[model samples]
Target: MANPQLHLLELNAKTGEVFLRLRKFPNIILTPPRWEDEPLLIPYLNDPRVCDWLSGPPYPYTLQDSKDFLARIKPPADEVIQHLKDADPAAAPIIVGECPVWSIREVRGSEEVFLGGISIIRCENGELMGPNGVDWENKKKREEENNALAVGDPSIIWTIGDWLAPSHHGRGIMTDVIRTLLNDWAVPRMGVRHVWATAFTGNEGSVKVFLKNGFKLVTTHENHVVVKGKMRGLHLLEWQYEG
Candidate 1:
């Protein structure tokens, strides 16, 4: 059977950001998620706070459900990295840094530490998806169509996702974590100049994070996302760095 490693290269786009060409993370000292993390991930997924905005995998997300999820989530060796340490069932692990793309923990340290993940589509010149340049036929089309681009033009924008353990909530952990990822990682590694985030309109907490982090409210679309069988509005936000 062909190893999944063979497909790992597929994770990169000639036009997007270039990841380190190996399995191990360079410049990051985080542990991988052990099988035990299933329990941690399960409760978070089932949390109404997190689940409400996400497209459902069904309510009452269970340990079995998390197991199935982890089982299916094969990390792309080159582009996707998962860090793990044996997690103590009693508490959340301290994470110092995380995968810049998916925001998975890459640096685990103190228990109260907060980690955030960020992903930026790297756009490069002379590639199949579309060559990099001023020509944004593909990107404009994606914006106009309300379509999902698996990874977007790296040069133009970075799609950021923020994840935090429940214990770390409401104390500016997520905001600080996001700032750290953008300042310390994404801009440095991926040359990301702009950050984009989508939050369900009703998710005031998330929207506040984006706003507090300097993302300007650009637009809103009604019925943009389906969650729990209902359509909800979504807010589009952007933070640009002119420097």
Candidate 2:
């Protein structure tokens, strides 16, 4: 069984517009992926950095691989609802956790959708190694630091896995996506206290997004991520939402 932490839900394409309801942020429409988007998703999955974080695709990715993955993500049975009570509301609209997971999509012309990105909450008890490099002795210390930094309330760390289409890059699409996610979680529900994000030191693009969205740099590792075989520095960031 899929970890109850992760479950899928389907929404009527019309209601899915709830995904695009944010008028303040315009670059993104929060709709599902259309069947034609498989072509777009393929290149995103095949992108060098994207492939690094994901498990499959043997280097030069093939179109067939993309098609196969989509075939696996069949459409929803009926309208779906995901409930994520313990998740950080300031992160992504796609909630993924022990509570619930939501997948946002763009409605197609008549009856279809497209997949966007996955937003997840990863819990750590100070014993596990986090993306930034906390293990054993340092783990407890970091957790304590995080707790102290949070000033006593529970800390909900956030991370995003965005395979955003290239055409969408630099267009403020990501910013729109994040704002909508925050709005949904900040009102009429449990509000998140803080959010965490990490980016390879050189990824200026992602760094900007996090900053623009309110995430601040908390720490940085001189050489953290190993991509294509080389260790690169990483920046650890955080954000707090007030609603």
Best by TM-score: 2
lDDT tens digits, residue span 1-243, model 2: 222211222234454422333345432344433346557666667676566544334455667766675564423311222333233455454332221223444434564344456453332334333565545567776565544433124364545545455555676666666666555542122235566666777778778887888888877777554655668676777777664
Instruction: Give Cα distance to truth, residue 45, candidate 2, Å.
Output: 1.4
Per-candidate TM-scores read 0.57, 0.59
Clashes per model (N, Cα, C within 3 A): 18, 10
C-alpha lDDT of all candidate models, in order: 0.50, 0.50
State the weakest 10-residue window (summed lDDT) of model 2: 1-10
Candidate 2: residue pairs that collide: 10-80, 31-105, 31-106, 32-105, 32-106, 32-114, 33-113, 33-114, 34-113, 34-114
Give the top-scoring candidate (lDDT).
2
RMSD of each: 12.6, 8.5
